[model samples]
Structure formats: structure tokens, C-alpha cells
Target: MKISAAGPDVDMIRVDAERLHNMVSGHAFYSELPKDVRGKIGKRKAPHYLRSQEERNVASSINHDYYNSATMFLSQYVHTLPFALSQLSLTHAGDSGALQLVSMPLQYSMPFMAKAIAGIETLWPDMRLEMPEDVRNLADTWDLLAEQGVKGVGT
Candidate 1:
């Protein structure tokens, strides 16, 4: 998200948004702003990536649904401390045990990795990048297993 936000896109670096970034990234100065202006800004989601062509194209691609759903799901486990703590109860420590704790985040991160690769391929088509066979095999295995009502963990 930060990568796309910090990209060379003009709209991504809008004056108002840069001002907001400057305000937050420096001293805690939000209170210095007028109450009405602060309220309006606080009520909205900032740095809206949908305004960017790259993000819009990726959002409209084959990975659209999974991208949004997984991002929302994973973002909770990531950014919100209380929600992440609450989800610890859902962690199944099987034979792999505590390693599941580490692996689970990496598993959820796969979609982001895929999105990055897709972006690279889109931006540099001459590079003719290809998904590694093992990655493709795992995706196929996941789809096949999902059809059988299996989550494909440890499979």
C-alpha cells in the first residue's frame, strides 16, 4: 500500500494529501487544524488508492475479489492490535505447532505477492515474467483441494 501510495503518480501525491502526510508524519499537529476541517478529514479514508490508474487496473483485474477480501481480512490481523490479539484464539497449533503462527501470516500474504508480480509483468511486459512452476502448482492444488471442502493446510 505504501509502495503504491509513494509511487510517481501525480494524483497519488495530491497537495492536500501531502499536507495531511506532513501533518501526521511530523509532530502531532492535527489539533492545530480547525475543528470542522479536522472532523471532515477524520471521517474519511485518506490516501484513497482507487484514484490511481495502477491501483484501479489491478482492482479491476481477475484478482479483484480475492484482493479486496484478503486485504480487508489480513489488514485486521495486521494493523489493529486488539483485533489481532482476539484472533489468536483461532490459531490452530497442530503438529506444526507455533510455526503455524508464523506461516499463517505468510499464507495470507500470498495475494499481495501475486499482485506485486502482476504489477511487474504489467509494467514491464518485455521482461516476459512468469510465475514459478511451484507457485502455479500450489495455486492449482489449493483450488482442487478447496473444491473438496478442504482448507489445504498442511497438504
Candidate 2:
């Protein structure tokens, strides 16, 4: 997914993909791959050495404009470098390498929650799921903050 800002090489990507496919085919699958080339990913489906095909078929089915932008905005930091690197905190300070604890700014949590709330609001319009007043109020506040570009909380 990361195609450095400069640009991505089409041939290199194709080659890399083909190599990866060969590797997976040669040593990854338990038996022959299923005829329906859809999915059954994650490490549980593979041996320890290979990578999991982390996917989201439902997310793929969504309107890309809204879902992708929001996901990409948050995805880079969850476990990725730079963002993860920024979370290091000194839990202990001593000559023998200080113990570090990963800590990130709490501000990131709200936007994800707000987006989730938006999803819930959309899906629960029929009122099958009763949303609490406080949660609704909080979502409203988040929406307002986003609208005003307060803390870059919204789209």
C-alpha cells in the first residue's frame, strides 16, 4: 500500500507481486489453493514463517472515497513506523538503557470513535440499536469540532 511519495515502479511492483505469489504458492498454503480465489487469510491459515494476507473484503465493498481516506489517515500510526516510534516514553531513566513504554497522544482515539459512531448512526437509522444520549451528544460534539477544523478531527 505504501508507494513512497515520489512514485511507484509498475514493473517492480509486478515483479515483487509475482515473486511473493511464487513464494506463497511454493511454501505457504496448507494444500492446493481453493478454486474460488477469494480468501481465507491470517496466520492461522498459514505456517509461522509466512505473512498473513490481512484484508477487509467488506471495507473494499464500501464507497472508497469516504472509507479509504479515513482508514488511511488512521492506519499509518496504529502499528507503523514514525508514528509508533513517536510513542516511546521513558518509564525508567538510568545508565543501563532506560525502560521505554509506548505512549501516543490520546487525541487520535476520538476521531476513530467519531467515525465508528457515524457508521453506527448510519446503520441504526431504523433504531434497531438504541444509542445512548451521552454517546450521541459526544458524537455531535465531535462532528462540530470536525466541521470547524478543530484539531483536524473531521474529513
Report the number of the highest-lDDT candidate: 1
lDDT tens digits by residue: candidate 1, 8-76: 666755877878656764557667755665555665544433235445744444344444555676787
Candidate 1 CA-lDDT value: 0.57
lDDT of 2 by residue, 26-75 (tens): 66453555533324332224343232223341332223333444455456
TM-score of each: 0.40, 0.32
Please list the residue runs of candidate 1 whose C-alpha ends up more than 4 Å from where it truly belongs after superposition: 1-59, 62-65, 89-97, 129-132, 135-155
Q: Provide the lDDT at 65 for model 1.
A: 49
lDDT of 2: 0.49
- Summing lDDT over every window of 10 consecutive residues in candidate 2, give the lowest-scoring window: 49-58
In model 1, pairs of residues that clash are none
Candidate 2 backbone collisions, by pair: none
